[model samples]
Target: MSQLRLWGHWPLFLFLSGWCAVAIFLDYLYAGIPGRKYFLLLSGLSALLLGLSFPPFGFTPLIFFGFVPLFYIQEIADRNKTSELFYVYNAFVLWNIFDTYWVANAALLPGIVAIWLNSFFMLVPWIGAQWVGRKIPSLRWWSFASFWVVFEWIHHNWEISWPWLTLGNAWSSLTSWIQWYEYTGVFGGTLWTLIMNILFFQFILNLKKQLSIRKNSRTITLILCFLIFPVLISILIDRNFLAEGKYGEICVVQPNYEPHYEKFAVPEMEQITRLGRLAEINLTKDTRFILFPETCIGDIGGPVNSARVQDDNRIITFYDFIESHFNIPIVMGLTTIKFLRDGELDSPFKRTNQAFKEPYEIANSAVILKNRLEKNIPVYNKSRLVPGAEIFPYRRLLPFLSPLVDKLGGTVAGLATQKERTVFEAGNLVIAPVICYESIYGNYMRGYIKNGAQAIFIMTNDGWWDDTPGYKQHMAFSKLRAIEFRKPVIRSANTGISCFIDARGNLGKSLGYNVHSSINQGVTFSPYLSFYAKFGDLLAYLALLFATFFVILRLFRYFF
Candidate 1:
């Protein structure tokens, strides 16, 4: 009887013992550290506040002060002569989990790797700032700001890039306050965020030390000026800004196929026919172009040959439908394979077929097709691929990891990409054909405008992470691009959120998630480029130079 009773209460006993073990471990971890509770509290608070500041939760005002708690945690570490790694890593991991937990809905293993790896990368700048502060305390805050911008800039340019959490992106939805993005781009918002956080942190320190009223008031005044001045300037600019140019009507179709199940499993013609039906419902005689979502072609069948894409049965049907009814151009996304002949230019991304011994490369590409008479078709291969899903970063250095990369949804040799941003001309309209993952790159998009793109058209499939903030956040990020380039944006998604964004970052006629729909809207195209489009990320470049100088100075001091 006694043994039966003890076994019956095993669950309670296990819970009690596990809780005690965690408590003891935490106590040991912070043994010599003072204000242990405060440190832990600030870490959790930092993660919570920052995570809440992102989309789906969207507490935008909280972002201005979110990093204050992290700064406090750093101070505690410095004062106690303790390593801040564990605390900072925990905070970052928690923030990543809270904001991007939806990423696991696509793939379990790759999602975990993305979250953990991104967290580690985020820690680099913080740790570097800490080290620089120890070497030269007077330049501490400057180093922190400059190092962070440099990190974000590197993240945009590198192969292992993931700029989804860039601090400037926090204002993606609040475009009214960031109209200055046309002049400064998203990096300006990042600098604004960092400066505000630093000022608020200094005010907090003054309060802690019971500083004089005059000093506290001065800091408070500076914070208010920094916060209010930007908004006022942005308001004035938005009120005065006008989108001037030729107006053209475009039809965007959202054929809501479930990516994991219906998109690939269904036949190619069936999907094309559905897209045709949606386009027919919304397309008018004045419609200049019809846009389809990414990978709408070549999902059921294998990738079509780039040289003979028009020969595919699905393409024949789509082209016939457009030529018969509308006689207009259609820009759509597809996968294409290109074979290389002997003595041709070579690339490391090439793959060899075991059966025929032929060299070829596969690309996630967007192509614009007109009537059969049009011989030259324009195709732009996506250059910015998702790190694990579409590419294996540093493949030349780590050939041993090719098998692992293959398992993570990438090809063994990685996908091929084009060198230049291609613009497609349909009648009098010239637009940039931006693929799924390319819209988030502000600086990269500038190349299209410089190459004579008047408007931006993005084709994407956001259904992989179904019914999550991933799709919403992706849609929100496009607004930043529209503001930066001062160009109208037309987006077509496979599952939902297809709409038109104006030059001022305003949405017009949006379709919701999981809805099969289409929208016909007239958008104005600007011939003139914005300041940011003309000069790309100047602030980030300056920050990189400053960060490099600081590091060189620190090294000289250490050696001397």
Candidate 2:
């Protein structure tokens, strides 16, 4: 009963208090740490402030100053020769706890790992920056900026890749405020944020020293430009943008199937029947396409050949409905598998005892079914899989740990993915079929656009995270994709908040969370590709380059 009271709606309170106590105890060695308790308080408060800026709260502008407190602590640590890693790591852990505590709603153990592991990854750059700065104090700011940008880059590209807290993602809710994403991508936002924080850190330092306004005039001007310039650019872009291109209307179905009790538990035929009814309500004469959320196709044994996929009663039901009722195409998520030959490219962790006669199971795919064509339906397997839930990271390297990893999350073995991005050709409209979580990757999404996807259709199942910011933030990030590529986006989620967003990131039509509904909405297609769509994460690459240069230069100087 006592334990129940402590955890009831206030588990975070208990966790935070414990976290602070642990931090205080660990800082005993640095007891003479300048800014002592104030530094610790600043760290904790800044984490809280920054965490609140993301998703649900969406106080985006606060992110600009989020790191100021830490930078202050860093400055003091540097001058006093005190270790800052312990404090920095704790601050990041607090940030992760606040921003992604909803992860616990999915699974408790993995959620704890995600929060702590992500905090550790975030701590990497700070440690590197401090180490480098100790040698070249004059170049400390540049070192800090470079380390952070490089960390964000590494997080996005590596295995166990969870870039959820990449600083730029803070503006996800404020799509209109980040129109310049077309030019630099989210890494541009990262660069902009670090620059602002550094400028403000300098401003605060100057203020402490009673420096005259004239003495710090240049830094002040820079701070003003850093704050004002991005928003100004975004506003100008938002004002002038036009979505004049024409496209067929799309109908998105939200089956509102509860993952915990209804989705997998319910009969496939019944789920399909209900989905058809939802589509029927929303289907219009102008509707050229209808989309269903991920894994709504239920489960199938192994991969059915394209020619025979419609032979399956479950898939045939939807195919027949489209043939008998409307000329429009339907796309949906499926759990599918494919057979591989003895010498074929199999999963890296394939069993040696398994016969070639036996087929391997693959999951998480999207398929397109249109007018009664004899040809096979085009299917694209999801590539950007969730770390623990979908793909066990570095399975080939750590095959022995599969059981341990799977028990912590969802899968023992990861799903297989196609090497190239697949674009579904539906008559005049070519669609990019993006699965859930795949939508978060801008560079990966650009491949579909580059392959001639006029517009994107994202199918997701957000039911696992419940009605938390997980779903809302997922939806908000889709808006950023729309702005970055200047293309209309059609999103269909398993349970709710399914929406149609225009090229300029404006909402067209949407269904609320937990609502069972569908909507037919017009979407414009653009042949126009933004700089980001063409160049892809150039800012991140440049930042990496800068970091490499600094590291090499510092090493040379240190040895000499």
Candidate 3:
């Protein structure tokens, strides 16, 4: 199936493996010492590289998974029992690499490599915990469990954040086990993975010394059950969910028009408008809402403030067209501009951290257009931003990054997000809009449901980097969001894989990553809610607090 078949593939695999080795080595360099002067500096660089893995540059696969064995070797070779702590910490820290970007190959060998490399240090903590279990004797397995989850939570919150590949997501293939995610969230899957890891490690460590077949056989049996029981049960019980199908009809627009090409290009405009028009025309009468990918428009400077610009502006012209022609409400990802000082409409250029000192502000934004009514609409700017491309973390310190900042090519800091999800209504439908890259953050998604969003809308531009796992992982994030909120999610991407996620988190259908493919599919609308929707960030905060205190106490014991 791969074109590589024509090449001497065995050597190709070696070359690919060599590339991975180098990536892992660079990750090591980026993972500076815990208390070093440049620790935060390396961390920032790490996050940028992590975010770059998403789009417009899809290098995440080789670098993230490729060279990870280095960390394992380093941790294992360290003679000091405590020395393993930093290495264990570093592995997850480097794993933050995979969190922010999803390479297209994450489902195949490349993806598996990334997962194993990211998780290699998982064994570090498991071993150290077993050793410390003898030394300090704290609460049993939950200590390591709590440590890992808290570690994951940190990466789950930043610009370079990627939370899609938790060992728990692996259970997506093991449907029966993950069915509980509808109630417990994906962490449940990760927790099970930890338990199995512990069991297997212990079983192997004690294998040769055991004298009798009975004890060893029983341990082996327990290990097998630990690994397989959840998977088997998960597959069987998924049917129960399928039987009580409460599906919705929603459509998503994947305008395969690339953004690097000017959106205002006459031909591009026709194509985008045509796709939106087609979405409007093809909607089933039952379709509750329609979604457009993020910034379906290609050009940056001209249409910055499309939503709330001059009264007779071009932005409004597009809105007026959609409202007048389409009977169904449309939720779209749009880029708009806002004058900073409330001054003249002209672009003012100011210099801040050498980035967007320019007067014209570009924000990655989302707008809701309710059928044929275009006045006084609700809009939300993306709160969290991508580091290199959206908002650089420490631009003030990195003076040389001036050109790099300008390259993100959009508005800096859209709006000071209210830290709350805002909602709008369409013919009894309550639509919540999630901008590109923000869907991966569960806390942000949950706030929308808590505020009353019966259906979720996601707008993204995956073509920035092509059909990498970044796009697939983006879709996976939407699936989890739907499961977490107990509401349907409709995602539209510029390149492909546009899809509708059901309230139950099933993929109804999707568009391919290939060029020029337009997709129309039904999405559901429902008020079905979950524990996570009702109690947003409560569990995450609690986990954070516990890990903080435990780590502090351990630090005191070790050095203070």
TM-score of the candidate numbered 3? 0.71
- How many angstroms is residue 430 displaced in model 3 relative to the true structure, after the best TM-score fit? 0.9
Model 3: CA > 4 A from native: 1-143, 211-213, 216-248, 261-268, 284-286, 298-301, 304-326, 341-360, 371-373, 394-418, 515-519, 537-560
Span of 10 residues, lowest total lDDT, candidate 2: 1-10
Report the CA-based lDDT of candidate 2 relative to the real structure.
0.80
User: Model 3 over residues 383-448: C-alpha lDDT tens digits?
Assistant: 766544556545456657556445544233323343567787877767788888788776667777
Quick one: RMSD of model 2? 3.4
- What's the ranking of the predictions by lDDT, best on top? 1, 2, 3
* Cand. 1 TM to true fold: 0.93
RMSD of each: 6.3, 3.4, 8.6
1-560 per-residue lDDT for model 2 (tens digits): 01111122243554567777788787765676565656778888789778987886889878878888888888777677666677778889999888776666666677777889999988888777766776787777788798898898888877798888888888877777788988888888888888888888889999999999999898899998888888999999889887766578889999987775567766787888889999999787888899999988645233444335667667777778997666778889887766556686556433222544555656688988875554667778899987887778887788897786777765665677888999998776888999998998888899999998889899998776666677888888888888888889899998747999988777789998889889998878777888998999888878888888878878977998
Residue 76 lDDT in candidate 1: 74
C-alpha positional error of residue 347 in candidate 2 after TM-score superposition, expressed in Å: 3.6
RMSD of 3: 8.6
lDDT of 1 by residue, 108-196 (tens): 66766777788899889887887788888667777889999989999999988988889898898688999999988889989898999
Clashes by residue pair, model 2 = 303-337
